[model samples]
Target chain A: MKNEDKDLTRRKTIGWILRAGIGAVIAAIVVKTSRRSSGGRLVWQIDPRKCIQCGKCETACVLQQSAVKCVHGIQMCGYCKLCFGYFKPDAPRLDEAAENQICPTGALIRKFIEPPYFEYTVDEDLCTGCGLCVKGCTNFGNGSLYLQVRHDICVNCNACRIAEVCPSDAFVQVPENDPYLLKELLPRET
Target chain B: MRSNILENCMLNIGYWILAAVAMAAPLTLTAASRFPQPEFDSGYVAHKMPHPAPDFAVTPMMDILILVVALCIAVVLVRKVRSRNWILFFGLICLGWFGFIRNGCFCPIGTIQNVALSLFTGVRLPLVMGLFFAVPLIFSLLSGRVFCSVICPLGALQELFIVKPLRMPKSLDATLRIIPLIVLSVGIVCAVNGAGFIICRTDPFVGIFRQSAALPMLLTGMGVLLVGTVVARPYCRYFCPYGVLLEICSLISWKQVELTSNECINCRLCVGMCPVDAIEAPRPALSDKVRGRQFKQFLYLLVFLPIIILAGAGVGHLAGAGVAQLHPGVMLVEKWQSVEEHDEDLFPSIEAFKRSGGTIEQAKMQAAEIVGRFREGCMYSGVFIGLILGLRLLVLSKLQGRKVHQASRSRCVACGRCFSVCPNK
Candidate 1:
């Protein structure tokens, strides 16, 4: 072959090799990611039942604010003036006093609807997932307030800090499909 | 007798007091005696969390296959067939698969940030993201930007609206070319510092792909599509950081598309026809002595390239603080560091951190770490931009000896518009 023809042939061969190399690399990455995650996406979630209300969710999250959030099942709530979630057991009076408030951030807003009834509403912005209110409510009153991994806020880190520190082993690996394990949120069609 | 009357009055008052306490007790207890509060009278239930569509949720294996196929098609069309019609078919098919079926979010443009995050930070990006990021560059190395020519859904969608071609002023076009560099730099810096992907967030096509998005984002997507009708591949030419990467690789590519495979007859037919205006006419030849002098001058510029890069690094480091502020943690800490100054807009993250018992010192420390990463990212970005600019200058000064109408490898997307116009074909 002439010199120019030889150069063209050489360039073509190198191009083919480059193409093959790219293909192999892509295949390798796909296999590697699948193998690493066990062929399924790992989603971080909190189990309500086994949670000890240890207040670790507030601090252990990689995000400054933990993805774990405190949610109140309105159906489970009693709207009581002397709510165990809202007030200390030995509070001096049935009033919204600093000493009587159980939540550290005052996230639980107590609204007087009628003569004797006060509705407890959680301002999620103010809630830190400390679970002080959940603990107080679960122990003294009917278990209503609970902690759940808010899907929007959670980055779904591979290794969850809340899970590691959870005393009751409440954290469990669920598919990315059904992420949140809310106490009253349809129970995953079970 | 007086003691008996006093005892009688006390007994009567005590009975009335007891009655009042008994009556108020039931009313004080809100769901008073009920253990479980009754369900709402309206009988509303919480809705299930939205799930990815059945068609959209393909296996990882399928993702790789689709990517490989698209890449192959791009290669074959550019190097072998070189047909404009086939290229248009390829774009339409990609628009269906990547734009509608798979969703446009998982694109090379978006994945640029993913790869950057993976390299700079410990973000575990999806495997397909790595593929989408790499395949385009690999294709560009062998053939040129065939991926941008058709396989890229964002480009394909824009091409469909390329009705009336309008020439963007060369000055504005050149200045706007700096955007992709800045965008890539800012994206990497912000992502490394735990800020979310800025590119993906602002992706104009994502809203249309998903069929639903925030109102503002949807409007922006529509606006880009409208502008695309007049200006061909505005995002691909000006905004896509991945396109910038492809351009860099394509410059050193083995083979590239030309206006004509055979010799050009000095035809001005292809002039003023390029959407991106990548075509450059052959300049008049210079004498050997002057060429030698010009070559020496170019060498001096090459020697000065490193100094240019270092100066850029300095400028970047100065601007690094602004980049760091994009991060939520840094923003929150910077605002709430004093703790005494009640910040008006108390973000949810800030409030949560304060309530979580985290100290101002800890938040400040995290912010400093993020800022450090941003500074490092800025330095690297500055070096990158400076290197590209210097190389571009070097190439511009060198005279092309060829007399044929040749394609500008870096700017030609290989959309195959000039193929039919060629007499050799």
Candidate 2:
């Protein structure tokens, strides 16, 4: 009977020690995550330059129309009348005909700017991040159009599909402040 | 030079400390880092060199809290708490919180791939992630698989749906048990070779958590959940790659998690209680001659381990070429440069490359980089699988005469079901 009592006591002590170890690990996890989690709520976004015009942002996202939207740099645009982004590459004319658009969704809206230049702006709701217009512009004209994660629509899935399938790996977790990487003037190379 | 060394050490320490805190939250702990290039666009025409330190991603600190609570709950269930219903109720709560609320992102099961990736690819591992991956395995070694029995949400969810547990024959169970080993080997090989986390991509329960997945995956999850109503944690027994580590640890465990809190009465009441068919009936004593022959057979198999490992390596090398397609780089190369793998209307990866104007040369370079990693990793994974097979066979051949029905230490999940059936209670 004495031996049984002693065995029971030893088992209890061992259990207590195990419990203490678990407590310590839990405390460590709490301390670490809490300390790291204070700065700001950062969410996934695409860096325009790193984007390789992968249309995956449109299709891969769990959301029906992807949270990724095309953002045009207003300042970078030469505002050409024959906007490569607006008209298909082999279009008969530079005119804004619905049939001549390269964008499957026709999200790019053309506007009258100067005599030979026309400004193109993205329709945020219609922009599906298909990257067709961005591809066209980057390939032919000044690379003004780029994709960005629209925070309002993005669920910010822990694993961003665009990031996963991205050939260039352009997607990043950017702070909510300074969300968009806008266009800026550059020193042209001679 | 001394000062430089000290400074570098300090920086490294500080970086790790901060990284530990970052890993505390269950953000996607993917093996590879996202946003490879810091540049926004190649032709921004701005001062792009001085890229600001991107804001630290601050997700909810709920995952850490849940994990800690899970540990507490497992202890409570095992040591203090007596009621099985209460344990099931707690499992339901965990299923809701960890599964649906958190959406199962930083699952320890999936972290096996990340751990493997960090080992091979020099990916920086966060301290919290290392702890998360190690804790369950350690628990299994020191005590038993408390993690599988109670902690993991994936298992917890399955526990809730276990309405009528069925048993399978011992041979079939042994055959199915090898699957987790295969998955672990394949998962590690693909992850190390830059194929990304195939385990996470193909995770059966993730669909249940997200409330949204591809139709086929969602249906598969639903089907599994439905089957779980009768089969009792089929995935846990057969498919979970993470279970392989826990199973190994449990096999060599010092502390045993038996069926009862006290001595089992040998009443055979607890015989069919184990949901995953982990309990074994008392075996009649084997004659000395039969036991001697079995021992001899075991010795013969032991001598063949090296040959088995070499054969496994050979098979693994052959599979590496096929597995390389999991990497987008390899797929891109095959679609454009090699042009031998497919005859489709263009897979999404190829279509993405086309829009980006990616060249075949670039694809070839990417393919070579990925395939090169596989040349080393895949062969090792195969040898590991062979080692596992050899050891399992050796263990199977060993005969220990038994007088009492026993819980297979490696297979038992320690869910405390048989505890309720003890007549001593």
Candidate 3:
């Protein structure tokens, strides 16, 4: 009985030692890694420069309608009489006709500003994020239109399905405070 | 009037000169500069892009607080209160909060990959994720498997669905139990080699919680739940990588849930109550002769351990080459080869690579490196699995004699069903 009691005590001591050792290791890892860890919430965004306009973002998202939407850089716009982003390349005339629009969903709304310059805006409710308009703008005119993850609609899946299928690997994680990867300035050669 | 006309002519000439300079500039300049910004005569301001706010507002600190509070309640309920109904109610709350409300991301089970990746590859482990991984383990060491009992949303989800619990054969149960250790080893190996979080990718419950998963994953979740109705916490018992860690911790835990507060009446009422088959019946003491034979068998098995591990490594080395095909880089190379052979159109990935100015030679080299890493990871994982299996066999060969019906320290989830069923209570 005495020997059994001694065995029990020894086992208990070993358990305690193991627990303490594990706790210390955990503490050390936390202290060591915290400094290098990316602070704050990390949310997914797209780098406009690397995006290939693959049109996968429309169908690949976990949401019923994708969180990706076409964002126009108003400052970058050429404000041309015939905006490629707003109208198809082979449009019969520079008019706001549904068949002539580059956007399949007619999400791009063109408003007359002056005799020569036109103002373009995206209707978020109607935008399907197919990147067709983006492709048109990028190929023919100033590449101002780009797809971005709208945080309001995005559930922020751990593994973004769109990122998985992205051919150019444009998807990147940005800090929650600055989620949008906006095209503020034109890409210039260094 | 003559001076004003001269000013207008000079301004037009200056604008034409600027346009000429821009047109002559190299193509390196962005397309945006092709057309000059219209000088808005009406003083109209261009609309700046709007950054919408995120929907979920819960902070990491709040999540940690709730996790800690839930663990404490589980421990108290299991050890002190000993109410199965209360534990069930608590589990339901955890399922709602962690599963549905949080969308099931960054759970302890999935954190195993992050922790493994961080430890092996020197990747910076997020502070919140590190805490999420460690706290449950610490709690399990202090108190046996209370985390598994009520705190884990996955386990809770399974528990909620358990109906008509059927007993599995002891041999089958023990065999299936080895799968979790294998999964843990493979999961860690994949994470360390930067392959990807296989555990999170394959998590059946997370899909159900998020309500937005691929068709196969949804089908898998439904299948697991359907199986869980009879098997009782099938994922927890046979598949959860985190559960393997919790089981180890709980085995050496300082305290455990008592089946009965009073002396065992030997009525055997609680034996059948445990849905997970965690209860052990009394065993007759082994004679010295039988013990000597078992000791000899253990000694023989110990000698074969190294040979077993080497065999496993050899098999893994072969399997690794095949498994490496799962990597996207390797798949890309394979696809490129097939396209070359068949004279097919370039795939999207290949097109992107070509557009980015990456040569096929560069892609082939990257794929070769990933294959090498996969082989190394698989070999290491094989060794780990072999070691675990050997140790398990050794332990099983020399079993201890039990005096009364009791819960298995490592297996019992502390759901308190046994306590409710114990006649002595």
Candidate 4:
């Protein structure tokens, strides 16, 4: 091949390399940035200061079932037999009968804590968004159980459907720019 | 000589003006949404524009007719480049301009449907839904690829950037063709699943020409355009789903962008010149006796067509089933299908379940059926696209390869080789 032809080929080859390289770089940036930011250490949590954990989260979500699972604040519980969070005020029986217990998934296990005292801990897997337990606890006893948005499932539509219908309007459009919403219980005063 | 140049210049100038007018008028009038919003430091979110179809009475028929007219004009131009026909090309160009610019949309094939669906369905915000799928198919049936040749913003932009052209190897071009099909298949799968429109999301060229300032998409668009300067319409040739539609349409087209000004001499001047590598040398015409023998074998083509279609569809159906089997969403939907007597009257009442504190695992199981059906839809679309491309290749192989031609089909990048090569020009 002639010298001129060789030079042209060299130029074209360089051009192709530059183009391909640039395309790859741009694609890499987009795929990296648009992710839900699970990499951050702070997970989505319920703010104890803000949460009333009303059963409304259970009803208004667009998902076939709401994914707002109830979380427990173990430190706040007094372990009373008449645990306000566990039983409805109109309960006919105090024993662990299905109708008497407010927890639907039977996630909250109630254990006897001496005379007139009971303690409660939550089993994460079976908890559904019925919020009956949350309503029982917050209304009659110290508000410990609360509803929180699980980032894993929330589609995070630009306008959250739940936020619109929320009676408490508890749902907030947290910035994807800074993703975590906390539900931590501060250390109780000794 | 001056008069001839003047006429050609006049034609070119007229088309340019029509293109501008076609683009601007629609944008001003209808104000359709700008897609893949350009990003900048100011953080300007793309302002959502109302659907323009209502204002102009846009319909699939209008898109189809305009494409047909455009095809007619293109055919006439190659067959006989007259001043009057040039006028027709201008008119068609104007329609394309009106369709896009005035309407403030890209490729009206699907835009009209999007508007209608938004006004009527009250569901998902479709990026490019409804009529888009139908518009291209109808035009492909009536005339050759009208959308790809002109009017497509990407195509129009490509026309400007292709200042120089170089030949790509046949092996390379064939390899590149595979990429577009893969992209089209992926896009279809994503769309069917209601995930997102991959075509709009991943469009690199649209970003570059339109100055999509969105850093990520804009950067991608720039990357593609820069490649075009060297490779020539890389997006259209290798990736555009619209291109796939056009290729299928070209097969049945009464009008073709012809290679030769007169009879094929096998000189191959046109082959090297085509930037998109469209032109090829004609095969040796059979003598009457040879032709008679070929005619005897023509019945086989009819038999093959149905066989190909059935095989394609069957394969597509099975693949779709396979995807449905794997997706969690499909499985979830299946569980809910039998239970019709629900509060909301929908199989998977997501809201009701959310209230109950449901897990993703549960939703996945319940929504599985919906997911499966969508996969099945996507698989069929993929198989059909594959069959069309296969048929195109089969027909293309029968023609004479442009081996000895000065410009082979693979070598030509539609760089206007024959325009200057023409003795008439």
Candidate 5:
């Protein structure tokens, strides 16, 4: 009986020690794994330069509506009313209306300047991917508006659905390594 | 019985710890080095699918090959096939191709997990974590613990730790099953809640299997593995969310590894030998018709196919675009580009550009382009989600014996005829 008790005690002690060791190991791995800094592996990547910002992403996407929304690049704007990006080649009238306004969201807020000159700004919260504004800007004004994949919500599938349907073919598949493919512009352009 | 139970409990714990330690060592080294890229990972811009870390992937492939060879040998042990030549052919492939090189570069499970975690949590856990979760679950479900039988590094490590095999109390073993479920549930909840990936933080098996990341909770995972070595794959048996999924999948899995009843001669050796308790004691044979119908019933879960697709589309729509908010890595990109910092200037110029249509040479055109592409991507995401869910359901449904007779199973008997002639059999 005494021998049996000693054996049992030995097993119990060993078990406890083993359990402690396991705990330490798992802690170590989690600590190690979490610390690794590999970059994101996003499937839907955009080239800011290639994007004409036609806003096809808003309409052509397979979602019920569209997940594409408008975003801004603040550094490069002159903000003029004959705003090459927003206005038609020849305007019947300059007043804001469904026909005159390039943006579907009425997201563009115009500030008055001298006659025939106005500054416009985008209400990002309201801007959808309907590229009415982008098309207007690129064709008539500076090509400021461009499309991008909002990494926050992108599913990043192996094969991107938008890439297949894109009329412009602007999308490209980024490698699992160094996922982001942000657009680069010349110093003068920015 | 008491002594056996005691020994089983001790051994089980030992095995768990051993496996956990083995898995953890490499991962810890990685963590200390700021999680350096695996040697095989191609850092080229074109390679978007994350590669599995070398330590985790390479070791397991070898182990799996070894197991396949052993099983083939066992197959020869039980059944005498008239086409002995075919057996040699199969043995070579099983030992060479499948055993050595897993054909697929990225395991499906890993991709699914990465996408899922990115959606739910705001962080992109290392792509390896996703694969780590996937490999075992895929193998166990499709091939019946073939992963456990052969290629899992943690499993192999635990075998070394286990000094003795002892009978454990069924009640205790049964109770431990809850661990994996709890772990899985917590992981999912944490992921969805945007709290963090519990799997990454507390994955006990990964510590022993792969070196992916470094989180504070790895210590706990290691402890769990050490305990498992003596106890017999406590993670697989009780705590792996992927394991639970594999268990559900095994219900309809077409392929299974087992000993034939005819050749068994009532020997119970295999039963005791199974480390994870996956084997079932042979029961009285049920009528083929009943078995067929039961199989058909299992397949009925596929009807929800369209619903799954629609749900994904609908949810994708509601979730809105801009995956950056949901994934920290994307957020990092936003930071790198300074999107939020210059919001005031960026918004107006882009807005003006959209208003103008490139008459101006300002940054507005760039902004306009970005907005346009993002919208389209969102739409495609919805469609893709819908299609995937629909197809998954369809496949699950189709698996349910849609036809009264199957080409694979319609043979003369559960006979060794096809088994003998087949290369993969």
Candidate 6:
């Protein structure tokens, strides 16, 4: 009986020592890692310059409807009479026709401002983010139309599925306070 | 007429210069004006870009508060209340909050990778993520694996599916338990080297909680839940990397759930009542000769430990080379090479690389560097695994006499089911 008591006490003391050791290790890790930590929440964003518009964003997201949507930088738009982002490259006419529209979903709305200038707006609800319009705009006109992760829709998965399959490696984590990485915006600012 | 032709030629030259500048410097041109916007006769103004705010229903602070409260309640219920029904009710609440409401983001299971990556790389661990990783471990050290019993949503989800528990063969159970340790080693290795978060990628429950996933992943989640009906918390038992840490902490916990408040009556009612089969039956004291044999076996294992570790390292070095192919840089280089060899039209990544002005040689060098890191990490992981296996064998060979039926310190999740079965209360 005396031997059992001594054994139990020895085991308890050993447990205490291990507990203290583990606690110290955890504290050290916290101190070391916190010094370098970015100290804010991060959300995934697509770098427009790197994005090759591989069309994976539409399919790879965990959401039923992808969070990625085309966002236009109006400042960068040329407001061309024949907008490559709006009309198909081989369109029979420049008029607003379903056959002549570049966007598969017709999410791009073209509004006439004057004789030769037109305005383009994206319908976020209808935009599938296939990047077909982005491809056309970047290749032929002022590359104003680009894809951005819609923060409101994005659940912000811990490791984004789209990021894993992104051909351009365009997906990057930005501070949640300023999430959009749109064209005409400097990368460093975000 | 001569002056008119000169003016037209000058205008064409100006347009050419503007187009060349636009093509060469897209970003700078965008920052300025690529093609000058036509002066608006109607005075129509361009709208400012609208940035939508992210919806955070339960903020990080709220998540931490709930986690702490659930853990505290779990400890009390398991230790003081000792009611399986209360634990079940509380676990359901945690499941709803952490699983469906939060969509399983920022979980302690996935936080292992974040902590690891932060430790080894420049990737900064968020404060909330660091806290999420550490708090459960701290609680486990203090009061056993109360976190597993009622706080972890993944475990709770599995617990809900348990219909009729089946007893696994002892040998099979022991063998399967090694998988979590192996997973922990590989997960840490991959995360530290910035490969990927294998834990989050392989999580079977996250898809179900979010109600969206690839077909394969959704099927996997369903399959785990279905098997859970009979097996009871199979993922927690054989797969969870975080559980490996919790097991270690709980092994040396300050306090753990006791089977009874009174003396043991040697009744076997509580035996096999544990859903997880954590109860160990009482054993007669071992003979001196058997102890001597075990001591001999221990010494033999000690002698062979280094050999085992070296063999493991050799296998791991080979497997690491294969695993390195999964790295994006390595995969990109391989794809580029294939495209070059076949004279194929440029793929998206290859085109992106060309646009970025990166040479193939530079890409190869980068891939080589990543592959080297993988090899080193896998070799170290192999050594660690081998050491764990060796130690486990040595411990198993050691003879320890027990006189009472009690919960296994490392295996028991402190669910308090055994307490209810004990008539001594």
- Which candidate should be chosen as best, given lDDT against the real structure? 6
Over B308-421, each residue of candidate 2 has an lDDT whose tens digit, in order, gives: 999989988887777777787887776665454454225656655654676667768778877867766678888998999888888877587777767888788878787787
Q: What is the lDDT of residue B167 in candidate 6?
A: 94
Select the stronger candidate by TM-score from 1 and 2.
2
Write the residue-wise lDDT of candidate 3 on B1-425 in tens digits: 78656754654464356446645666676777667788988777788767697766677667678889989989999988898999999999988888888888768898888777777767675577788888898898888999987988898998988887899998998899888977887777666765556787778988778777778888988899999999999999999989988987888788987889888887888877788988878887789889788889989999989987887788767778777876778888888887864353347788788777787899999999989988888887788777777777777885467788878888899888888888777
Maximum-TM-score candidate: 6
Compute the lDDT for candidate 3. Answer: 0.81
Query: What ranking emerges by TM-score with the best candidate at the front?
Result: 6, 3, 2, 1, 4, 5
TM-score head-to-head 4 vs 5, winner: 4
Model 4 clash tally, residue pairs:
65
- Model 6 spans > 4 angstroms off: A1-3, A35-39, A187-190, B1-32, B340-346
Pick the winner on TM-score between candidates 1 and 5.
1
Compared with the true structure, what per-residue lDDT tens digits does model 3 show for residues A1-190? 9999999999888888998887788678766655354546568898988887888999988777899999998888888776767766455455787876879898998888876888888999999999998886776567788889999888776667788778788898777777887775534432
Q: Could you tell me every candidate's TM-score relative to the true structure?
A: 0.68, 0.73, 0.91, 0.45, 0.33, 0.91
Error of 3 at B204 (Å): 1.3
Each candidate's root-mean-square deviation in Å?
A: 10.8, 14.4, 6.1, 25.8, 26.8, 4.7
User: lDDT-based ranking, best first?
Assistant: 6, 3, 1, 2, 4, 5
Q: Give the per-residue lDDT digits (tens) of candidate 4, residues B1-425.
A: 78756754654464345335534554223211211112234432222111111122334346446645664554444346623335334534654454333331345432322332333334332222233344444443434454554445566566557667688888888878866665666555644454334465556643343322246666677777788898888878877765654554444443334444555566555556567766654456666776665655555554566677666666666666654543334544454544543543232334435545765567665555555665566556656655765554555434222332333322222233465555433
TM-score (0 to 1) of chain B for each candidate: 0.82, 0.78, 0.89, 0.57, 0.39, 0.89
lDDT of 2 at A160: 68
- What digit string (tens of lDDT, one per residue) describes model 6 on residues B264-345? 7779887768889988888877899998998898899999999889877877787787878868778889988877544533
Using Cα atoms, each model's DockQ against the true complex is 0.11, 0.07, 0.37, 0.01, 0.02, 0.42
Evaluate model 4: give its TM-score: 0.45
Candidate 4's displacement at residue A159, Å, is 17
User: What is the per-residue lDDT of model 5 for residues A1-190, given as tens digits with 9 covering 90 to 100?
Assistant: 9998999799767655644554454344334433255423334566654555645577554342354555444323434444544543333345565555667567776766444445566665576677676655544334445455655444343334455444344676554443444322323221
For candidate 1, write residues A88-164 as lDDT tens digits: 64454456877768888889888876655666778888989999888766655555678888766665433354664
lDDT of each: 0.71, 0.69, 0.81, 0.50, 0.44, 0.82
TM-score of chain A of each: 0.74, 0.84, 0.91, 0.62, 0.60, 0.92
